[model samples]
Target: MTLAIENGSGKATQWQKVMVVAEPTRESAAALHYVLSRVVFDNDILYLLHVENPTFWKTCFKKQSSSTSREGGGCYGGCIGGDVDFLDQMKSACEVVHPRLKVKVSRVETDAKEKAYVIISETKVHGIDLLVVGKRQSLANAILGQSINGTIRETAEYLVENSKCTCVAVQRKGQTGGYLLHTKTHRNFWLLA
Candidate 1:
């Protein structure tokens, strides 16, 4: 799917508001950082968003309630700390590299489908000029039942199919660890990771 992008009036094009779909993984973190480093302008506002399954909290609650650990000790694996930490790291990197950029973080609890809708809606509401998403696995591999990214890959596909803003899906090349495929942004570009 493609959106009708209005070209700048013979002036240099700059993204003002950029939103990156983030997950608690290396690929997503890399994608966020890559976009911040390559596309964001000094005055741009960057939003780092993560859509989490609400059931994750329920499971964590159950684990904490039935825990064998001491009071105030809970399941760190199920906590949102990892996600928040990842965002913080990205924000710090952005500040260091693009000192004038503003960074914002948001965590939304919802299912995959609702997550996609929320992303699209938020982009429109925030007037985002660029939307970046990271795909954990190849689309072909995911369709072949080798899914690793799971809901994240689906959310990325949904954004590619439905978002009205310029959307880029960053996919990591296997093993090589330095090649990235930027899908669905007028032209497909490969970058060294």
Candidate 2:
């Protein structure tokens, strides 16, 4: 079955707070595009949640310009590195589709917690009605024997099972095919256009 999206803005529905875990990945951008173009309504609040992993800094940045130490090279603070550009593009696309939609940027640190747990916490704290995250299979996943189809990595799976709000883990099927959608009750369901 396809993922159902109701765009009945004329109906009397509660204002929704929809959060999408934004990362600098093709799958993440696809998820954002899906939500902006389908799931979110004009009155909904869209939140882009970025969880900064300190370990990522080791490979991505040289120094901490805002808070602490400089490690290897350049500065990185208040930025999701250069990937924030993609985030801006996603926001612009959302605005073009939903001019009245309110998009909020939430930047948080993992703070040594599991990323999934951090996401769940944020969902509860924000009282989100819906949450979306990208699902992708990596080489490490294959080596770890997590080569299951339609099942996302640990983060999306854990978020789906534990988050307070309804969660969707999605991977784009192709440029025009639609998406591979997963939810608490659905796994690897293909939502074709």
Candidate 3:
């Protein structure tokens, strides 16, 4: 499958279906919905994937086990986590714009690195023409100098460089309601220049 974006001027062009991969986050969900609404296409599919990375829990368990000498050591109370159904949330969110869009949800338990590989592989298996991902913002990226955005950037660059499909990284920006006007004005200025 090949995804092509064409300006809706006066020309004949082929339109391929677009696949959007949205993680279950408020920002990501909002951005996905916004992009889908803005884009005019006949064939489009939205894929929502929830990846549960075990590294966070593994590290937490390791730290708790090392601090105590009991056979079953427990420093912090073990509480049940991972019960949140992100896929369900995504489904409900997408249902708001039903009939106009086709949405699919999948839940996978894998680390970030493994998840990235799975996404790439699935893109091929599912005949995805384009891959859309969200850019996450965290304080660690600001202070610790590492973040999910960096991983996404590296992953996107590698995929775009190596794969045959097109990749897009969508970020949630504040709605100014002047983007269209700004772009047109800029274009006019450039033409005059």
Cα lDDT listed for each candidate:
0.72, 0.76, 0.53
| TM-score preference between candidates 2 and 3, better one | 2
TM-score of each: 0.70, 0.74, 0.56
Candidate No. with top TM-score: 2
Can you tell me which runs of candidate 3 are displaced by over 4 Å? 2-16, 40-43, 55-84, 137-163, 177-193
lDDT of 1 by residue, 8-107 (tens): 7765545478899877676786677678657887667889988888787777767776867645576564254222576677778889988988889888
Candidate 2 Cα misplacement greater than 4 A, ranges: 1-13, 63-84, 111-113, 139-153
Judge candidate 3 at residue 30 and give its lDDT: 48
Give per-residue CA lDDT, model 2, range 16-131, as digits (tens): 88999987777788889889777988778899998878776664554444435344335433335443475677778788989999998887877535778888888889888899
When 1 and 3 are scored with TM-score, the better candidate is 1
Compute the lDDT of residue 173 as modeled in candidate 2. Answer: 81
Lowest summed lDDT across 10 adjacent residues in model 3 is found at 184-193
Candidate 3, residues 83-177, lDDT tens digits: the string is 56656766676667555566777656777677667767777777776665654445654464433555543443344445556665544545543
- Candidate ranking under lDDT, highest first, comes to 2, 1, 3
Supply the global lDDT for candidate 3. Answer: 0.53
Model 2 weakest 10-residue run by lDDT: 70-79
TM-score for predicted model 3 compared with the true structure: 0.56
Residue 111 miss distance in model 1 (angstroms):
2.9
Query: What would the C-alpha RMSD of candidate 1 be, to one decimal place?
Result: 6.0
